[model samples]
Target: MMLNANLWWHDVDVVRRPPLEGDTDADIVIVGAGYTGLWTAYYLRKLDPTRNVLVVEAGHAGWGASGRNGGWCSAELPVGIGTLASKYGRSQALAMRQAGREAVNEIGRVIAEEDIECGWRKDGTIWLARNEPQRARLMAKLAEEREYDIGEGPTPVDPADLAVPGLLAAAHTPHCAALHPAKLAVGLAGAAVRHGVRIVEETRALEVRPGMVLTDRGQITARVVVQATEAYSGLLPGQIRRVLPLTSRVIATEPIPDALWRHIGWPGRATMSDQSLMFPYLQRTSDNRLVIGGRSIGYRYGAVPRTNHRDDERAWEVLEREIPTMFPALADIPISHRWSGVLGVHRDWQPRVTYDLATGLASAGGYVGDGVALSNLAGRTLAALITGTDSPANRLCWVGPPGRRWEPEPLPYLAIQAITALTALVDTRESRTGGSTGLAARLMGIAGK
Candidate 1:
């Protein structure tokens, strides 16, 4: 079957579910079939065997960002240590980081226990510094990690180790792993079904209220309703600003030859990236393909898509240009796939979990571009809160904040466009001049505060 959204699904066989027909009533209702919804459904069944759970999806499972991501299940939270420390105190901030690391391992544990066939490798990730500004930025992050003992912070690696050109220094951390994203998503959906959770696909949820969800098919009334629609949450009534849908584009190259692999010398297959404002993330597929993603190449005006295609030519051009610049040795490699997907971005760019006991409404998202692992973390937290388990994951610092919505229409659109343009300009200027440009530093300062 031809993959609808991503290269990761090209060879995998997905089991499809028919759309919901007629009105349905359940004990728990989820509004999205992506990772968050499926994971929540899965855990709810595991926690309470008698609860009637139903999941509704706009497209197939994994059709959203869950299927089209960089595939680095990194141990990084959406928020940084210092920011978390300032907001929730230092100990809670440290506990948040520890929970993130556990979540990463938990993904592996669950995949193995469930016998999911996703290609998973615990090879870790590396951030390369190709310029002085990038090197300084990398070191600044490292200094903070070292100061706080925040797990295995980036370690310095030699330029020769990466076999890439113009590498000043490199930072390596074992806190990340590479996986086939679509496989994990589809696997989770299948696993949830096997555990007695009902999932309905191709069912668009128009509105999600406290105890009911209005869908294209029909209405679903349940005791508890979860608005798990990450990027598409804007489409719902009264949630246009809960999260902004920012487009992230990616391209995958044909399998490289063994001789080229010898030159690349990435036996560990570490997910790689460079330090740039508009930086790219890299992953080597199990089938030996190269997949890379560029950040926020296109922004949806008013948090909505302008076209159905969603793919941007400028973003594709950036991938083509950056790949050769990073590795001249692989300049001859051909791009096999080009696809784009949008991810949710909070105004503060922090991932959060919100649940109201009185309303029986809950949500977990706003992961920015780091949702792959953070989504799993959000799933566990949402499950605990819904079931009244009183677990540590539910009480974490990220769960307390009632995230402010985005600015009104024209303002959000304008702000996103200006930030994207400014960041691109900053990256360009920093690449040319090795001096201490305060562009990224200033942006970081403002964002953290």
Candidate 2:
């Protein structure tokens, strides 16, 4: 029973493969056929044409966030530039930022060269500040970028120019691209298969040990075993504490008329987000619909939610409330779809990609909510690590160690509840006073760093 949540399905064609039936062995086996796993396999075959690679998935390919994201293939990393600088000198931080920018362009290039019909657009992204606290945060971010000598960082835009109501200010960057996520995922999967990568769907991995992966039907043995399961990693043994799975929900409105779009005046199709703790991201789809998503949806215990369901009524209410506040022009527009998906969040909130050659095991995940472009970088870097090739991505600061495990049961539950309550309180205060009651936001920033 697949969830009927993803709007990208309208344009994608899916081919489901049979599950792993008997004991299988390959040179390398990848668990989880999402973007990370598919891209890794694609690069692996590209690098070594003869290396035997097999990808096994619990569901069909692109069943995870790879197929169900906000579709902003933006050049954003979960780790901040300032944090990277403070950890590993300014030069290394700048190099990492450059690598990220290159990765963004690389995605666009891949889509074009492969001729994936994902509605690729590179109008860039706009960060709108609708209130005083948001403006301060944007200014602080600009100052940090300037300090790091980031020439292509966000540039300020006056509210008068944007014409968005309640827009204190806005920033623009040309690095982010928009595309249909499912199209890219499906296309990549097809490319990997065409490149001689074997893919087995409906094979649930129960445990991932060094050089061996235990599954519901049988076991797979390989020289290298790569765990690409992001949020669903908790289902495997000894992996629950590694990440906290948080739900992110999205809603799309019916196609709006050209007249309504002109009245709104945002024809650039730039991926847009506001300065909120529960950051809301909006996009103008190629078909003239508006898709909005946020992370205020509730979380499930032990990082496992109902797998076959997509309904999140509370999340729908949140988006419904926010739509009127942000874009009054679409107040009466009917919602066409509503869905939710979970993403992995490290305890420290930084994304990680780790490979251990000694154990013949590597895992790449914990992208927080920014896996769109980061997953591409992770796939390429993981390939380099497995093949012992030295690429700039392999040398990135995020490549060495895995994330620290989360705290025990009661702690994660209590902390998340408290944090959600605090976030709501802070949002209310900021909205009411239009002032700097940004303690919650500041704490979250500090924790992620």
Candidate 3:
């Protein structure tokens, strides 16, 4: 049922498969079968078919964020412009942005070649603006994005119409795209199998201790172990520092009629809500429903939220009232469903492509919410590193885990939820009063400019 509601990208032939049994040994073993691992396996096979690759999942493939989350196939940097310039410098940032731009195209190519039925829409996206401060900030983003060598530039809604306008600004780029993330995940799994990559589901990897992964059903002893669990990265290569878990959410509006679509003017458009730190994002599916996301909260000073469904429901309510506010016609519309997932966030919001110099283990995450595009780059980075290719990718430095530099915070679930609710309360007020900024925005880094 949870799976069915997220149907825009599902395929009948790609239903969840059975789990693995008995001991297994392969040349390489992968943990977590979400987008990252699936693509890793797929591309690895593309690199070599007879390498004896084995992949194990805690649940069905795509069951995590892969199956039940927003399908925004974006290539833009989710990290703020200021951070990108500060860390990687302009040239490397440009390459990172270019990788994002190229990812959607690569995703499309793989889908087409495999004949996967996931709804793949290459239409551009819009960064819907909601408030005055947001609009002002967006104006700055538009200019700054132009400065960056983004494959495409942002289109502003200068003096945007908020009451009737979907957003104060609609940042569109051919580089960012959308698709049924679930189907793509499943398709990749199936493709991996076709390429001689064995996949195992319903198996939890309890421990990773040098060449052996202890699973509930059995143990996997392999030569190489790759930790593909991005958001839930830890337990392997050690949890990244400053790379805390952020709970983001998504919800689908009842199938919007084509007439409403005419009013929205985004049959081919998607939107990212504006926030210096974390904010909401929305887009039209291949079908006519609006899939909204980006309503998120930082991990309890340290721990990840276990009940993102509840958080997502709360986020859905925020969108329910606000999405209608964006377009009056959408006011009375019903919401079809909602779900949530966590992302790996570095302090600065850049992804980590960390390869432990001490250990043979290699892992990457900290994409913040930009993993869709950046992970592809990480895959290439990983392949290059493994095969000992001397491409420029070898020099890339990922956000190392913040364990030694930072200590974990003890998060009491209820208090953390309250903090999130408080943020939304302030946001609701700002959204209603035209727009907002200043202290609150700065706290989140919206004063990003």
Candidate 4:
């Protein structure tokens, strides 16, 4: 097994495509071969097979957060529905939420149509409330969902169903699915290739300009250029603060025995996470291994993005401790892998899909770690916008201007660290007292807005 390699990567073999060798021209050029880029490329050709579409990747496809994430294809957005309604109006917020739900099924439809076998399971997600405070928060959220009449919103589940210590309540929502992220990424790349999309791997995009993409290999001129780098957007010149990069670490346990799994009691294998401020997300792999991940690390100064953090002992240590703490049955299980990846966070904590017809520049990202399903929506929306499809997706709230840029360095770095530290502290206080800290709400307002 490779150190710091995504556990999902273990399920597939990666072969790099030929890199760009010289200056080229295309109908559409997209930088970053992650889900957003590949999905856009896949859909663009689907919409119009005659268009020349090219995708350039710094590494191989799925090398970034796309392949390294927690494998959650969830409809949950980074910001809450209420927050969206407050900012973009109620109808638009509801429309965006509905779009997310549809996006989950859309991904499933594509996977089945493409015949990509990536352990696709629509088992949904389970959110655990481990303390009184967490329970109150969950109930409040459920009430809000009811108030908005969101379809199939989270419903209560018996805490006993989770079989975790101190669990006071649980909620399940069908709008999430679990899958092998790397396999999905690789498979999408293959699907795009089959659809006449050219993917150039190991080609670093230096900068993206109007109708042009400058790369290490050569310049690419196209009628339209899309920037889908997400967290790595900071690596490009003049985009240092466009999106902040935050590190998330993950650890995977060796396959648990059938008897032990039965004792643990998640028969559906629904993706699971607690309501803790520094929450940890868990998933059961098709092979029966347990994967857990969380935001165990804070932002780096200057928003630098690193491919691997194998040397980050502190982050891995935090994740390693979570397995035993959350599930005593796994106390002795060996952790087979540990890895870390960076996710993009916009200033408003909302994802966006923007296309500027005047400059032939387009972009979609800032998913804040909830991008698996959202990326599909963005791709379809981007394709619709670029091809003049006049679809309803273009009317979604995210299909407008890129929101405010993150504050200059030191400020973002400091604020992120403070929030991270405060979150941990609040979780600790809530756990010990079994009462509301009253700080989480304040923090959410400041952090997301």
Sequence-dependent TM-score of model 4: 0.97
Estimate candidate 1's alpha-carbon lDDT, on a 0 to 1 scale: 0.83
Ranking of candidates on TM-score, top first = 4, 1, 2, 3
Instruction: List, residue by residue over 1-449, the lDDT tens digit for candidate 3.
Output: 23314554433444566677878788778888887777777777777676777888987888766675667778766666556667668776676666677777888888899887677877766665566766666677777777884545765544243335535455655666777777777787888888888898888888765577778879988766777776666443345344556677677876788877776554455544564234667777777777877655645444552444554566667766657666777887777766667776554445666555445466666666667766666776765665555656556445344323234444334444665665666676676676564556545552123
Could you give me the TM-score of model 2 versus the true structure? 0.95
Top-TM-score structure, candidate number: 4
Q: Which candidate leads the pack in lDDT? A: 4
In model 2, what lDDT does residue 35 have?
Answer: 89
| lDDT of candidates 1 onward, in order | 0.83, 0.83, 0.66, 0.87
Q: Name the weakest run of 10 consecutive residues (lDDT summed) in model 3.
A: 399-408
TM-score of each: 0.96, 0.95, 0.87, 0.97
Q: Evaluate residue 319 in candidate 1 and report its C-alpha lDDT on the 0 to 100 scale.
A: 84
With a 3 Å backbone cut-off (N, CA, C), the pairs that clash in candidate 2 are: none
Q: After aligning candidate 1 to the native by TM-score, how far in Å is the CA of 429 from where it should be?
A: 1.7
Write candidate 1's Cα lDDT for 105-206 as tens digits.
989999999999788987888888889998888887788888768656667777887678778988788888899999999999999999999999999988
Stretches > 4 Å off in candidate 2: 1-4, 305-311
Identify the runs in model 4 with alpha carbons over 4 angstroms from their true place: 1-4, 307-311
List the lowest-lDDT window of 10 residues for candidate 1. Answer: 305-314
| Count: clashes, candidate 4 | 0
Root-mean-square deviation per candidate: 2.0, 2.3, 3.5, 1.6
